[model samples]
Target: MAKFSVVVVFLLLSPFIDGLRFLVVGGTGRVGGSAGAYLCRLSRAEGYDPSDVTLILGGRSSSSYEASKARISSKLIALGLAVPSIEFLMVDLDTPIVPLTATIESCSPTILIHTAGPFQQRTDPNLLKSAIALNIPYVDVCDEPSLCSKSKALSSTVPAIVGAGIWPGTSAIMATEAVHHLRKFENSGDISFPCDDETIDLSFYTAGTGNAGATIVSATFLLLCQKALTFSNGKKAEIEPWIGSRSVDFGGDVQTKTVRLLDNPDVFTLQSSLSSPNISSRFATSPELWNLLFGAMKTSIPKFILEDKNLMQRLAVFSLPVIRFVDSFVGATNAMRVDVSSKSGNSVTFRVIHDDLEECVGLATASFAYEVLKGMDAGIYYPSDLGEEERKGILERVKKEAVLWDFETSYDK
Candidate 1:
């Protein structure tokens, strides 16, 4: 009788599960395409009804939308899964506020994933506001610190997770786990204050990863225009962008690479999420020549041009051809290293390396989407604050697609 009852309950709930829908705002782009593909694969793997769960690839025009559909459909077929109920939602965030909101509302996604970026230098929160009004959970792969902070403020009205991809997302979770281990295992020393004595260092290296489209180029220029932020000695610190350069060993065939400090959302989000008193983050690209050229530009470019969004974006748009050419030499590798230490004399380190940044980013975002599908009471969360179960799930999901993934620890004794 009990088994029959369970079967009956499953039958009743199956339809609700099948109704799940995912709408990717920048679906035609690398990040969005990767995510939409993986989300569809994962949904099927999790036993969700493939026919019921819709994958909406949002694009500005029908041509672009059809292109995205074709791309993701191929990816799904390659993975041995029939493409789910795939469709396109016409959405242009650049559209006027009301129509943009109307288009988003019309999709009626169970959870909206926002990957449209160069999320830098923007003050509008119309999409997020619409998500709030619609009362659906929203997730963003936002890397910009200021914009993340602004979006975070809307947590009271809707369920949201900001900075939910790659460095800012997985890197933050690694830091949190390292700190968690240190607080629980390091008792040899009398250092009881985890918040006052711990330090977290994050390093990232990417070799022409992602689509490197105009948005990526523009965001890169924008980051170069501003100062990098860090938390150290129990306080906040700001340093010149691309100044604190260092060599990072990414292990497992990736070897050592050079990285430089750049502002990332984790620099701000980790301050409140981890008990670590000190935190630092840095990023660098591959192909040494590019760094040299970027270095030369640092001093050669006029300050006004660097600081002006319009000018920098124009420069980025024009430079895409050369950037794409350089990418051939860099080989599309993305790596991250995080070191966490407590004065209690314990420490842990984590390294994640993937040869394909686009797919890896999709995996990371899908991991977060998996968690978002699990209902959360309306609130805002950083990747670092995710519960242990969710963290483990994301880490596991990441390993399935990563080329090299490692976690290590040590004690003072």
Candidate 2:
């Protein structure tokens, strides 16, 4: 009877042992593709049975929605993963929003990691509401600050943690930690104040990629079509996108890099989220990728390419051949540095290192997704509700995977 009771107790908790089914909406895109591929690998490396995961990739419904599933299933098999079913659901800015809600509901996903966006590039009330309607722990890798800032307002509606990718996501976490750890309390140091700020300085850097393909192209059109919101000293100002370019060293090998203010969600995200009196975000790239940057020069004749909707498609086709062509010297890395200081003479800095950053953003985003899913209870939510312990665990996890370094110093005022 005692042994039978034990077995029954074990059976009762069996549901808890199941691996999470992460519904990746844009699972076929750059970030999502990398995430779906890496997630299983990451899960396995961490001792999770990767087989336990179920990935559903959604694309615009073809001639027959059911027909695409076989092809998608074959691709997953080729990757040596289980046959993840591809639901031929039509998704676009115009697709009905409730279907998104129903699809999510049908999946009954433990979490939703959305990467399919150009929300800021093109705002859709229905799509945004559909995303909001899911109301079950939702996260996005959106690179638009407008969406990110607006996402914060929806926190009461759903646990929406926007900017789950690098800049606004990890960088924000780093910024928060940078703010907290860089300053020490004076007499209050004896009591251990986590943070007290009278002054702040910060710089954000991303050497990998930003607003690639149509997203960049379209947002630039938006800038041309409307006044770009300029953020300076925690206030909204106006500025032009390409014209406001500045060259700053995103710091070395990736040295003396020139950066421009690309239309990213992080810009607005940091603006509204932090109390910093001085802040600037730097967009960067390796010198070898000058062509891609040149492609970004929207005002130039080369700008014709920017008008092409097939730009990302062409990139995918050519990326492989180009990389192999330059394999001997085609090196890439992603690094971000945050330097913060207080009036008294205190400072904290963290530098993250990664070899391939396109995938790094996905990794960082997915890791955060995993944690958010693990920690979320029922109803809506966002990262703001995370307690200190959860925050520390996330920071530590990012630091470990990020291979980050920490250095601090203080002196007498």
Candidate 3:
């Protein structure tokens, strides 16, 4: 049979019923949409009676999010999922908060996955505060370091979970696992992270750039060249992001990539959440991706190398295509990986791969959603706060529903 057919066949065979009433705030977006679709499919497979569940997608007018809604709903239908009744709204941060709360209360969904955001745009403190007041479990696939920092600070009265996407979710879990297993990784002098015997410099290749655009790309490259954050003897310090540059073979001739610094929220959260004296959230390059990035870097670097042009200038112009491709890809599906290593050199890696990027995103976001809905009666929390019992279940949830696996790298990079 054809590839699509095989997927459909498998969906038909998979067990489905995990009953819950869900309301997805940014339900039309990739991650939220994928979540809705997954629930619908699960509902279908388990022979969910309509009375058993209701997935109300919370988002703006159809004109604004029709494409996302269509994409998700269509996929759900294809997988033989029940057609969930979608609830559309005219939500903008500027809109009166009263109606938003009222709408939410009306649905009173047992779970709320909030994807709507002024996150990187202008981040609304009101929405977060109000969501917390409502006392319903809420989750956001937020991508903001400043905000993650704030969330880290306010893990008390929030009644909500922030940074619900891949980095904060799956990746955060990875760091937790690494920290949990670290047996006396007390390196107070070690500034470099994951300082294995291998190369420290990673030729980080990226698929997407979040709100910061190529500035992030430049920043990442710069991090490789500068001292990055480190924790030694249970204290934190800064070291060169790439002062310890070296190449480790990703698999094949990936040019033995260099690890570079990235000021992503994941790094901040990993630091905030994990107890690793040395937690570095850097980017790496796969061979194919690196070749592409390197070629772009070359043409632009001739001027910088010979004259007064800067690397950032070169990368910015060169990354025009990268910007478009990555944004679209990120917008299309919320998929990523988080790698964690212990000081004693033991490590495990986890990736949330998707049949579609949306699926991967849904896996990540839903994990956070699950935690919020099922966790203790706390105000606010990050994934790092999770206990060992909760941690195992969260990992299990992803591995079972989404396509996940435990891989053993050859004790290398």
Candidate 4:
């Protein structure tokens, strides 16, 4: 009878014992590679045996994939963490939907994390659609508006999180928490913080390529050609990109950097989530000369060429040597400041600083994946969609990995 009972228990627990399989598309890239490594680290922290979690690094190039795997293993070993099972799957997102879907299906991943991007030019939510069709949970570091909208449209059909990277991911959560704190203060009757004319300012500074790949450079150049979307008194407006500069204090070694308005999908989601009347996102890069160079390119380069994604990518690749030489000096330090304020002068400020953009983005992305895999309900959701408890949990995890995090409030007396 005892033997039979033990067998039944093992049979019932087999699925859990077998563990989760994660398919990190673009896994060879900085964001994807960091995400996969952090996933392994976080899973180990959760007490899972290293063998229980499997990471399938999906990329088109086998050589790059192998290189990424070896690098990830070395990093994990340096941290004294055991490496999880890592595999490779050949996935070409540029291919037709049929072949891409088939490649994804071959992995049989329990969850799919899409990090491949230069999302600026991608019109179709092909990966999201594939995940829906395959009925696999999905998450992405997409920062593009149209793609995010298309992904959100499919929210009802699948369990997924879009814009799950650092800015659109953790930044969105920070905005939500700021608003919540303000409202809680208002409700306490300490002050009347009306939401009639709320404003949100997102300022970001990434030092020279942030030790990321060429795709980031391509995205930056592409953004230079696009119009920035901002909300003014609850109305939609578009302004020229890389203009409307502001100086923000990130309050650390990265104090007081100049940032110019940039287009980001987070603006749309934050507007809807907080119903803020005015919102804008701005970004800057270090070695100030680079900012000047970007400005010069934006004005001198023909709009058509800058708008051409493939051409811009090629330019970025060609410029990598110069960018890396600069990066060596500026060091990959990154910071973000989210300022939420009301017309009445009540405000909440949240700031995060990290030494490496690639690592922070990966950690933030992995935090979302951890939540989804831990059983977030089936639905398409933004970072703001996370409930209070869920938001706190995710933020806490991010804070642990962040170099510095601070929150402050000021109310007009």
Model 1 lDDT tens row, 203-304: 988887445366677777778778788887878888888888888898877688888888888878888676467888888776777777777777788767
What is the C-alpha lDDT profile of model 4 across 28-134, one tens digit per residue? 88889999999998987655677788999999899989999998999899999888889999888888988889889987887899999889988898998899888
**Which is superior by TM-score, 2 or 3?**
2
lDDT of each: 0.78, 0.53, 0.53, 0.86
lDDT of 2 by residue, 1-413 (tens): 53354345436754884455666676655566555555554566444566677666544545423443444455457768665433333455455666656765676564567767544444543434565566455667766555555556553343446666665577666666565555434434332232344233333444323423233334334433233344544566655554455554444455455555445444455445454555555455544364354435545544345445355335544554544344335444666666666556666665666556555666776667666544343323234334456566556655655544554445455
Instruction: Point out the higher-scoring one by lDDT: 2 or 4.
Output: 4
Best by lDDT: 4
**Model 1 clash tally, residue pairs:** 0
Task: Name the candidate, 1 or 4, with the larger TM-score value.
Answer: 4
Q: For residue 204, what is the lDDT in candidate 2? A: 41
Task: Identify the candidate with maximal TM-score.
Answer: 4
As for TM-score, the candidate ahead, 2 or 4, is: 4
Rank candidates by lDDT, best first: 4, 1, 3, 2
Consecutive 10-residue window with the lowest summed lDDT within model 1: 187-196
lDDT of 3 by residue, 1-413 (tens): 33344345436643552446788876755556767666565453334464466677777667646765687668866866656665565455556678667767676566677765425434454456556566555777665556666655654433466776655466676556654443224334343343343111112333354332343345444333333554554565565433344344343222234555443455556666544445455554333464346435434445334222254547665976866665564442223344555444555444444333446556667666655544345556667666777667667766665433444433432
- Flag regions of model 4 displaced more than 4 Å: 1-17, 155-157, 187-194
Would you give me the overall lDDT of model 3? 0.53
Model 2: weakest 10-residue lDDT segment is 208-217
